[model samples]
Target: MPENTERDWVLPTEIPFSELKGKDLEECVYWLLDAMGAKDLEWRIGGAGGGAADGGRDLEAHFFEPDEEGELRPQRWWVECKGRSGTVESQEVKEACNNALAYEGIDRLIIATNTQFSNPTRDWVKEWQRTFSRPRVQLWDRAHLERYLSRHP
Candidate 1:
């Protein structure tokens, strides 16, 4: 065995969030969701899925939660992974939320970012949620992702 082999992959805490972006970031979120029991995970292509989505590179998965009748129903989840060097913007988050909400049968929309969201952006999400609620919104930022990494590591 090589004595000088680096274990960077095993020590993800040393890796900065900026190191992950685009498809690389999305894939990480995809695997995390898989580990957390999200079912039928697929890369979203096109806005409607099957091709490039309006959100560009994103993911789709399902979480089975108890319905009103106590039956577990599959709730579709659209995950928008943003690995940005800068803070995640308001308009971009709005667009992603609106797009997912408009899309039929999308039970939840999670905007996962490797960077912190702008204050206004977070506020806007809160306002949007107060007015329009159906597709639940979750913002998983750098801290969240880091926690996930620590748990899974």
Candidate 2:
């Protein structure tokens, strides 16, 4: 198990997503991102166990990609770790999207959920992209996260 891992690991799948809740889920996401080389990560809790709100974002990360001139251009990403039993609603993502407007440098919005997103939310993101294109959206549903984690694990 990773250093931040809260429990023992099982073979094949390793950590079971269903058994995790609240902060545990957030920690898992953080660990996965850390393992994958995302830098400058901040774990922000919002309205859970009486913690102050985090403006709809759960984790924030920074990435640097070389530009055409070989300059490292910084990209900021806001990650929301949603541990849901059902499909994630659009409002949740919308809140995070809208919150991005209040910040200056956020260039990407990553919605990482234990469950899949609602169809309406997908449509909303598509529509949202057609208008404003600054913060590229990346939806890491359960299967997507599994694929990424399984490779690193």
Off by over 4 Å in 1: 1-12, 45-57
Cα lDDT of model 1 by residue, 1-153, tens digit: 858976656555665678888778888888888888888889764444234544532888899999999999999898888778989878779888887765778888889998889888888999999988878888999888888877775
Clashing pairs in 1: 45-51, 45-52, 45-53, 46-51, 46-52, 46-53, 47-53, 47-54
The number of residue pairs in model 1 that clash at the backbone is: 8
Candidate 2 regions exceeding 4 Å error are 1-14, 46-51
Best by lDDT: 1
lDDT of each: 0.81, 0.80
- Superposed Cα deviation of residue 7, candidate 1 (Å): 9.7
lDDT of 1 at 49: 29
Taking the tens digit of each residue's C-alpha lDDT, what string does model 2 give over 1-153?
657858765442555767655688788888888887788989987664634588768899888888899999988888887787878877888876777777787889898888788888888988887887868888888788788878766
Worst 10 residues of 1 by lDDT: 48-57
